[model samples]
Target: MITYSSNQPNLYLVGFMGTGKSVVGRRVAEALGMVFLDSDRVIEEKEGRAIRDIFAQDGEAYFRDLECKFAQMGHPKRGCVVSCGGGMVVPDYVRDLLKERGVVVVLHASVDVILERVSEEGHRPLLEGEDRRERIEALLQSRQGAYADAGEVVRTDGLTVNEVVRRVIGIYRLNEPNFPL
Candidate 1:
């Protein structure tokens, strides 16, 4: 098994929207005594605008460029629980970078669950002006390959946040034995 020299490799949570990346990442960080950061939040804070605004003003290409930039060097190199944007790992380059930077755990949920969880959420830019279920299905299908190859998988369908956090930490510890509890 590959071992991290620092023994505090970042934990990257990647998955489709509504699959609990942000929530799980926060709790996992707390449990592990690490800092937590949602990549999208960081981008929003830096840009001083919401993601929907960015997509509307600059277009998806520009927003994706931003995601790539963040993947490259926009956050701490280690010891952080990073909840990646759902599409962050779609790019091969960013996927490779995340794998290199730390342990990656892809969170998953059923389509129905996703629809239910995100139905009332207005912040999802991609779902705007489209049938929510269809958009979620298409997005999930397109990104499934990338998510599958990203790293270990954890289904968050019915699991509580704390349970998911424990599974992620188990995966983390399997890779980084010295990481704090």
Candidate 2:
């Protein structure tokens, strides 16, 4: 069993859409006995609108600005689990800020897997185009370096939600000094 210190820094989960950040993050937070926060959800709540609406009404740049603000001052507690949106870590400043605050784990999956998982969701602003697969591929390729630089990388392909949560907890445990193996 792994026990977290009261001083344990928050765990920030960063990944593309459909990589299970929100789903896995909830379980990880429950396991760690901490609060769970999703950045996109926070933004939506603050703006009184959905993310897709924000993007459509205010443009991606405006949405990115909101993301940066959230990265800076949205989180209200420590020893929590934060799940960031796909494009949140793309900005160097945001990535640096997240890294400074806590462990940034990048959850990843193949483009095909991402497409399959996100195909049913119509709320993705970036996938509003005709060829969603192509958009996903292009976005993944463009953001690959940023994701790699975010933190420890975990592949979610062919893995169940519990398996992913276990892996994240294992990785997190390795960073703690008082964890009992």
lDDT of 1 by residue, 74-146 (tens): 9988878899999999999899999988889999999999999898566788998999899999999999899
lDDT of 2 by residue, 17-112 (tens): 999999999999888887889999899899999998898888999999999999999885357789999999999999999887777889999999
Whole-model lDDT values for every prediction: 0.89, 0.87
Lowest lDDT 10-residue stretch of candidate 1: 1-10
Q: List the residue pairs that clash in candidate 1.
A: none
Task: Note each model's CA RMSD in angstroms.
Answer: 3.9, 2.8
| Alpha-carbon lDDT of model 1 | 0.89
Best model number under lDDT = 1
Q: What is the lDDT of residue 109 in candidate 1?
A: 96
